[model samples]
Target: MKTSRQNIEIEKGHAFVTIGMFDGVHRGHMCLVNNVVKLAGDTGGISVAVTFEPHPRMLLSGGDINLRFLTSLHEKEYLLARAGLDHLLVLDFNDQLRMMSACDFVERVLVGMLGMKHLIVGYDHHFGYGGNVNSTTLDDCAGRHGFDVSRVDALVDGDVSVSSTLIRQLLEEGELGRANSLLGYEYILKGRVVEGKKIGRKMGYPTANIEPDWQFKLIPADGVYAVEVTTGENLYKAMLYIGTRPTLETGGNRVIEANLFGFDGDLYGKDLTIFFKHRIRGDMKFSSSELLSKQIAKDKDETLQLLG
Candidate 1:
């Protein structure tokens, strides 16, 4: 996919566009993206996804709030490209753009700058300053600009709407199955191996400390999880831990580390991408190192049985 900043123009044919933060690029977002692709394909036009940088909330909050997102900008671009979009237009979102009325945005940004022939949006997607215009009102704005508009229905599973917020809640609650089901894929974290206190090593379970790539990336609930780790071309079944280590009593900061079964090598400085598969159990504090070791051994057994 061709990524363009700010304004975009198609040298040949028309531009069919969809607009959103598309945070996490969840299944709900994919439904809209797929529709755009289909429309563009049927009309022999270009499919475009217009997204904002820094997330609208980050700018709107004016440094008052630190927001976590499902995917980084790089990850979002990669997923959109794989979803079959012809172009991804990243708009620089600032105060001026945020204050623009929904009607003006439809005319100036979507219609004027992008020359959007067809506009697509999620079922409840809103427009204008502070989202004054919703999906229903968008059609009238589209009529004024002489462009077509389509709203993909909300993807519902068991009476709940599949959304970024829902997935985030599920992850933070350690509900991997529900989150992964709505995401249409496993949640992942990319990080570099860092040195730890070596307590796990003394207990005969060596683990590599992980430092996540992005501070704004959400960490799931503190617990032991069955995970798959990928580094270079190698993949390993591993058990992951996220907690403040009440047992160790060294510091208050939460630590993320993994022990890869059957792999014995130095991991410091190496990058690893962890795909969370299952939540084995919540963080537990044992009275002694020996007790913790026994529990870890049991956790490993359960992890192996689940992975197999």
Candidate 2:
């Protein structure tokens, strides 16, 4: 997909667009994106996914909020590209854009800039100054701007709407199975390998300590997980730990470390992407390192079985 910072001119009335933070690009977001793509095809227009960088909440809160994201900008871009969008426009959610009124945003950005001939949005999607604009307002804007507006009904799983918020809650509670089902894919954490105390190596299960690439990227709940690890072109079955070393008495920050099965390498300073498959167990305070080692061995076995 072509990505743009500044709007490019498309043929007049040839852009089918959807707009949102698209945090996880979860199933719900995909519903709208896919709809836009289909609508573009039906209407002889180009499909465009318009998202903002740094998340509007981050800018609005002046970085005071503790909100974490399901996907970083890069990850979101990758997902949007894979979703078959014709173009991806990332706008800077700066003061000037934030200050624009609802009507102004519609006319200036969607109509004037994007050449939006048709707009597809989630059923309850809202935007513009303080997000006071609603679907009704969008319909009115469409009337004046000479375009069409369509709303995709919420995608639901067992009566609950599929949403990024719900997915985040599931991840926080380590409900990997449900979260992945709603997401239509496993949750991923991307990071670079950092040096650790080499305790896992001593335990005979070497691990690559991961420092997440994005400060706001949400790490799943503290636990051991069955994961698929990808570094460059290689994929490995792995067991991942996300917590402090309670048994080792390592009093420090929480760490993300992954032990790749049947693999040996120096990964320090390299990047690793982890796709969480299942929660093996929550963080535990074993009475001894020997006990912890045994538990890890159990986790590895369980991981192999799950992955297999």
Return the TM-score for each candidate structure. Answer: 0.95, 0.97
lDDT of 2 by residue, 73-173 (tens): 88888888888899998899899999888889989988899878998888888888888797778778999999998888999899899999999999999
Candidate 1 similarity to native, TM-score = 0.95
RMSD of 1: 1.6
lDDT of 1 at 299: 97
Q: What TM-score does candidate 2 get on C-alpha atoms?
A: 0.97
Q: Where does candidate 1 have its weakest 10-residue lDDT segment?
A: 6-15
lDDT of 1 by residue, 166-234 (tens): 999999988988999999988989999998999789889999999989878888999999999998899
